[model samples]
Target: MGAVTPPDGFTFDGLVAKLAAHLRARGSLTDARWEEALRAVPRHLFAPAAAWFTSNHASAPRGRFALDDEPAAWWTAVYADTSVVLQTDDGAGDPLSGKGLFSSSVSAPGIVFPFLELLAPQKGDRILEIGTGSGWTAALLSWAAGANSVISIEVDPEMAARAAANLRKAGSAAQLVVGDGVKGWPEQAPFDRVHVTVGVSDIPMAWIEQTRPGGVIVLPWHAGGLVGHQLRLKVVNETTAVGRFHGTASYMMLREQRYNTRWSGHHHEAAHRSTTRISPRTFWDMDLGAQLLCIALVPRVSWYDVSEDGGDSLLLYELDDHAAEGSWAACDLKAGAAEAEVTQYGDRRLWDELSSAYRQWISLGRPGYDRFGLTVDPAGIQLWLDHPSARTWKMQT
Candidate 1:
């Protein structure tokens, strides 16, 4: 086969320079070393020949753009500050034909640089990276901390093979392993840094065991809910890792740690009917910290909103696959209304729990995500306000 042609009037050096400038202007690509790496590595090399571009509003990719067919569009996407999906539904569906959940992707540069800034790996630091994705992150890590010092793990064999090939083509010698990320590569135990590209509900003890004391493990953490926060934890000891939320970012959940919920979808026969002084907009307009607090306080609840001629309302469902019992709550919130009507069913009153958590969040001065921190150990994780010892809530496994 002959070599593929680059986009007309496109140069690698010029594209990299533009991408670097874009990231720097956004305040994400602050580190000089990371910027240099971004300029050096070619993102298109790691992306698939045909990839899907994602946006905030769309459920699946808007559509797939092929390199050979739409070279200019493909080149633009590669350099854009948005995520490009590589695989969909675990490679089960045809991404080019239909819509499906993104399985793996080259993350947006905006989030990628923030993660690298939080990681702050040194020259010779040993790093273990989870969810290798398109190998772009591994290549960047190698460029920053030496290719020989990085070991990246991917659960899917196909993704692993592709990532390895991409790394080799980029001349990066970062070691790529095909295995479960949750088990964490114990063979390379006591790494100075561990970076997880996927979102996790729980902090695995294996990760703590594999990280050296005082080492940093940066991961996107959520409490079994839709929204997630970036956690930057430092291994305090063999059994403990403590850190605070730096910011919020949505990531593909770790395959092993993905949560599946069974909803009964019965909302008419609620046992209790009441009204709340809280407006429907309270939850709808909640900040990241308050949103996370709701998940922390009321575990295993999935929330959504419905629009109708009567009014806009929020629904909360208790997700228990084994029980499959009808436990749900709804709040009918009308515009300009002083109060909202709430109805609860089954054993758990989800709306009441959410309201209580929201009140507590307000009582705490409505702290942002940066004020909340987590401590993980064999005893389970603790979500605290302000500091580690201050008022804390024990997280459900």
Candidate 2:
């Protein structure tokens, strides 16, 4: 056969625009800034290899292939509008450096957009961000919030420097500091908003101290027993704020604080061999709902570990605490059948409480995230849902 020509001619720009429009159509992108960021920021420059990836493992564990390894594949994957794991548990992918497992990645646009809307920073408002893995999110924040208003702290120096350079190339001149992001940059304290791209087992109280009262601080809150929840704190006072799980996303555990002993302490020796039948989707949905319920019941951790056996599996949420909590398989996938058996372990009977709370919420008409209003009182915080029932949790005064 004659030399194969490239499939038609799909320029990277065209592909990027197509993907951006796709997201826009879904209402995933609410602002015009998405296209602008897509056009302005150099995704190829940041991820030249551009691997093809998909989160769904319902079929099989078939993903994580590098495009650079195959030119045609890379060209297509570069513009797919999906999260691609750049580095794994091993390390960066320089054959010379050896292919490390994908522990970190550029989060999907779906996840990033919500937080962007939630933060809602005007161009002039100063913003601080923690965890600059791919720098893509920071670029978006800089574009919408203004580079001068954006000051991001990245714990991984290598990733931080790369992100800084990428930001510069994107024309976003935000201050990129190479340091531990958990500390919350003292110089940039009192920021209008602080968003963390990575997950954490514990709330870095410093984040609260640094953010201006009434400011928003968004991060993945991880607790032991494998439950991760999103937190959006609106500072009521210097010492405390009230917030709830906005949504869910996954991130590799931070280097120093990977486990909190509460999660990994009690491992099901036969976990890999556990026999349970559950429709993949139903099992996952219940597990997903269970995850959020647990977040509401036992808010902790900032990472995820998803698994499946035939059609049955568990969605294990984790905290920095050694305890890893997981939602039980509620379905036997062999047939369309579900049995709600939420397991509770650790010092915390985490899953049981979560499942029970979910039933209670259902009894109470199942209020959405908007129903949860965070009110700051002099002593601590009061999470008022539906304006009638309120849960009071203390914040350091």
Candidate 3:
């Protein structure tokens, strides 16, 4: 943002042309407006140390950590078409040592281009950006639509302030607010598009309430039980939303949405006959089921992880039904004169049923997420894979 010499070969115009070309080759970028936005905004001003994509360790820049002291190295790397770590573990680590949780980042140009395509912000539309990391995306929106058209919030004060400064330097002209984005700045309600950089588990009722009818909300959503399930979603109605998996991603869950890691003495132990007799791949997409379950059982339940000891058969791991405090594991086994075998503990049978549902979907023709669309109304939301085939998942009480 601040006027810095382009450092010889790094003229801003050259960077813009190169960025546009790189984006074009990725096939994820299409919007002309985005190119213009990239040209206008100064990426190097915000990025401290970008992760240099290279053939081997020697060529790749060592990231922000290495560039912290080396100003010229930092400047060149920051301008490249890559992501730079803006915060780690909430800004506790030195920007010089790459030791952090990557709390915030100026997403790689590859992602920024596609996401903007998915967002498709129109002129005069009010845009609400959830994670104001580096303020790069906000600057883009402000440049494309005008500064007054965008409202961005950051949960971390340091990141928020830096983003604000960057936007100011870029002359972005957008309103920057510091706070939890899940609350969706009510003051700027009815946003035409809401973009959340961080992933969330709960679909806040506030988001639905703030957006005007038909306004779109793009966000990353956590969808699974056990570890985590990341999915992108689009708001479709005042009370509902839907979307499909675009890519595998994991982010620090929202503060309020963070799951409890404590496993003992917290849930009820359910009675179940242990039985294991299935393929490990059968549970390939169990997290999808868990995601649907989370959307259904809000305020009370969520997926818990299950650990396992070597059982008498083939055993991997499983999810815990927190409401029931029950644990399950799939154990695999083999004997002198027998074939490969599997055993189940706790409620492993539930897993088989869950797997069967996915198998049925595959048999129906393993339709990718693209086919699945959303139809949301006051009554509820429907997952519309196809017309007439528009269906709704049962919301559990």
Candidate 4:
């Protein structure tokens, strides 16, 4: 990859224009309004003076780039279509130390634009945005819809304060509320749209109740795993909302909705051990939609980890519902091995269920994200393949 040149004069406006042009050239800024919004709201104003660059395996940030120390690098990062980490370890650890999980961030333009495109905001539309990280998305929403028509909620007070300052700096008048987003903001009910920036384990009923009957809700939905799917649900009536997966992406889970109980390093004596011809790659190499199908087929099973034993041998763990009394399963595979060893403990056979789900997915012609849809109603959430009338899997209540 070649280095991104700082715009002539290295001015903020120059950088903004350059970024907008880049996004347009890359086909991410296809919508004229969204392109204009990108031009209007400068990302640098919302990004922290000192921000961290993150990678997939990075537990913590490798280091921080201070604008004062490296203006060119900082400007390039802020303008680049990539996510910049703002906080780590739930805002408890040193980001420069390179040793914590990312808590908050300015999502990359690549992911952000698809969401805005799917949202398809219109003039005079009232929008409610969840997860006001860095206030960039809120500012974008304000630009898409009039500033007075958008309300953004954040859970962290400090983050909220920073977002408020950023919004003010960007001259955005969008409302910023510091509160849990799971409840949705009812004071401004019947909103035409609801956009959740954070990943949610379940579709909150509050969001459904607060939206107008015909309103749309766009969010990164993940049951209990790493990868998340983008869902664009339309409120059909007071009790139901249905939609199909528009795309695949991942985001940090909402703080209040995070799962606390997790599998620890322990092997149960009652674990049933067996060998199967199924390669571990069946689950490992699945696309985002297939991974999600595994979750839907076996609700409450979460992908744990994959470990290598200093050689070609690999171990994969899948944990059952956190509250399921430590139920878990592990599969051992070796290079060039024809069969993989599988072990299951606790009340549920997670591996068996996963294998069955994989076979079922194959029978369905290995559908993509667009082939699946979700229905939320009074009873519970249902995952359907092809159409709602097709085979459906009921999620745990």
Against the reference, the lDDT scores of all candidates come to 0.81, 0.58, 0.59, 0.77
Q: Candidate 4's error at 84, in angstroms?
A: 2.2
Q: Tens digits of per-residue lDDT for model 2 on 1-397? A: 1112224576667877776776676566777766677777656555535343644223212254554355555545545555666555535464222245455676766567767777777777888988787677777777778657788777766667767776766667677888888788998578889988776655667788888888998876544334445667787667776776666555566665565432242444423222322233432344443444334455543222344443343343444344334422221233334542333234444334444555665775655655654444443444466442454323211
Q: What's the CA error at residue 370 for candidate 3, in Å?
A: 1.9
- For candidate 1, write residues 1-397 as lDDT tens digits: 0124466788777777877887787787887877778767778878788877765332323456778777777776677776888788899976565477678989988888899999999889999999999899998888889759999999999989989989988889899999988899999788999999998887889998999999999998866544678889999998999998887778988876665443455646646999987766567657878877777898878776676776778887765644556578888877667788998898889889988988988998888877788899999988888889998998875
Top lDDT model: 1
Runs in model 2 with CA error above 4 Å? 1-8, 50-69, 90-101, 222-231, 255-257, 260-284, 287-293, 296-355, 362-365, 373-384, 387-389, 392-397
User: Weakest 10 consecutive residues, lDDT, candidate 1?
Assistant: 54-63
How high is each candidate's TM-score?
Answer: 0.92, 0.71, 0.73, 0.89
Off by over 4 Å in 3: 1-3, 49-76, 93-96, 225-237, 242-250, 260-354, 374-384, 387-389, 395-397
- Model 4 alpha-carbon drift over 4 Å, by segment: 1-14, 17-27, 55-63, 260-263, 268-270, 304-325
Question: Model 2, residue 240: what's the lDDT?
Answer: 74
Worst 10 residues of 4 by lDDT: 310-319
Local distance difference test, candidate 4: 0.77
Ranking by TM-score: 1, 4, 3, 2
Task: Rank the models by lDDT, top first.
Answer: 1, 4, 3, 2
Q: Please give the RMSD to the true structure for each candidate, in Å.
A: 2.7, 6.5, 5.9, 4.1
User: Could you tell which candidate, 2 or 4, scores higher by TM-score?
Assistant: 4
